[model samples]
Target: MKLIKTEDAVGHVLCHDMTQIIKGVTKDAIFRKGHVVTEADIPVLLSIGKDHLYVWEKEEGMIHENDGAEILCSICKGDHIERGNVKEGKIDLFAECDGLFKVNIELLNKINYLGEMMIATRNGNFPVKRGDKLAGTRIIPLIIEEEKMENAKAIVGDEKILEVKPFIHKKVGIVTTGNEVFYGRIEDQFTPVILNKLKEYSTELVEHVILNDDHEKITEAIVNLINKGADFVICTGGMSVDPDDKTPLAIKNTGAEIITYGAPVLPGAMFLLSYFNGDIPVVGLPGCVMYSKRTIFDLMLPRLMAGERITYEEISKLGHGGLCLSCDICTFPNCGFGKGM
Candidate 1:
């Protein structure tokens, strides 16, 4: 290889892969193939302080090692991820598995700033090997900071985190207790509505009981359902402050610890959540729950199926964003009202 002057090297692009420049100029002032350069060449190339340096090459799907998708997948678990076009430090992800997993949002930020990103799935806390299938990420776009990716790496070391909850076939018992619905006054629409929602998840109605607004009878029905091994018990109607409303008292009589007798949410503020000694979850649903699009039932049912333990503090925090207006379009799926679950 021959040496060339810095001026001669100005307009010439790399003809071949170049590495380890020897840094000298020949009297002929022309660089030949394989002629190396040194620190003196740094002044001419104008490349410095970048987290990444690369030779410009045109190739399809060549992503940076610090890409956001790769970083997110490394921390998140599951397979079947869809890739999206890279742009401005953000990537979309969708989970194919129906389970519970934690996301390290802080690590996502670092990949965003690193100029390129890749998405991968959590391979039990160690670095994921090449060609491992990642969870589908195309549906949910995740954004992160470019510099925070390194910090995300350090925190992800060898921790066997629970990525998703195993699917549990839930057996639910529905108790429709209301004077209006029990008699020939009105049709029992609440039962059908609750059944339709439960059908969306993996569940079966183990028992369905229609009782009047009598606390003793309602309590007996609940106890009977528990004895039948019902995982969840839902009591519909009679959740108001009216004298005839006795669902709350009935649930309390079953020796269940009432988590919250009322929630901050609208259209379902009269909702109640309680847990019996066997850890069976019992929900006291209000009348509006039947007709309202957004209610406490809508918020809690998903978490219940996901096997999350409902706490009073978490239910209390729902007040701020839980109010769902009956919009004409009914955009419940996109809305974040109960997404905290």
Candidate 2:
């Protein structure tokens, strides 16, 4: 990495295309930040009595946090933001009326960047008062390879440097295994329950299969699903110690590595998780999950849809909040007992 002073440049900034080669070194072979650059290494520039060398370091981005308290002020619909109303990102506003209001992140950014701004309300344009939370911004850290710093600088232009993490979408497959359901001895109510829970996320139920609790049959079914492109596969029923319970054996027979065969959660403590090629995930759920208000299935389904691979340690942590009170109100959406988002 090289840093030429502004005075040393004949005209504009002495920027180089750091995208390709840095000091005749390729990206794969370049030294990272915190690497020591000795003076003896600079044979050309050191010959001119230049003792100092430029080094690359990681840069961090700015983030602002907002308090939850906010107040609406009374003002006309066209009024602008009151000057000096916001100090240190806190604001005090007048109440136009009593109602639920939401301050989104976009409006907050505009207010912060452009200063005083106009807001739209139900009655009319009103001057925004203090103690109003405009928006919320999450802090993000950025890391740039030393060789790519120059390339970044040249293309930065008027854009702000922000680091965003890529979102990973998890694909899940469901396999319902039970002789009673397959032969119509009982209704196939389990699959519907699982599907209804999975519907809360962006997950696609890529494959669905029903197999008798035969080890070989279940094993073959699981292998076919994985081969058919299933990142996460769920097998319902046959998780207990009953002789007819062959789901665990079937999952093991597929040769997929098992992470945990039993979880510490209630109503679904017998849950199991396995993986193959460190990519595909497989789970075995117990019968209690079918009718339980909150089970291991409910707890883990969101994480799976959110692209989180469950670990045994994380599953173990659920024991504290695993018990469901099964209240009469049945406010599952607002309850934290295993249903908290």
Query: Judged by lDDT, which candidate is best?
Result: 1
Give candidate 2 misplaced runs (Cα > 4 Å).
1-171, 339-341
For each candidate in turn, the TM-score is 0.65, 0.52
Cα lDDT of candidate 1 equals 0.63
Off by more than 4 A, model 1: 1-72, 78-92, 99-150, 156-167, 339-341
Query: How high a TM-score does candidate 1 get?
Result: 0.65
Q: In terms of TM-score, how similar is model 2 to the real structure?
A: 0.52
**Over the stretch 1-341, how does candidate 1's per-residue lDDT look in tens digits?**
22344434543223233333335932232322222334555454433222222322323443232254455455544343334443333344443455433334444344334443443434221112223333333212223344555554565565421244434578899999988888969999998889888876789888999999999999999999989989899999888999988999999999999999998887788889998884788999998889887677877776677666789987887766677877888877456565443
Candidate 2: minimum summed lDDT over ten consecutive residues — where?
A: 63-72
Best by TM-score: 1
For each of the candidates, the C-alpha root-mean-square deviation to the true structure, in angstroms, is 11.7, 21.5
Which whole-number lDDT from 0 to 100 does residue 330 have in model 1?
86
Residue-level lDDT of model 2, residues 112-182, one tens digit each, is 34322223322111112233332222111122233332332243333322111122355667889889988
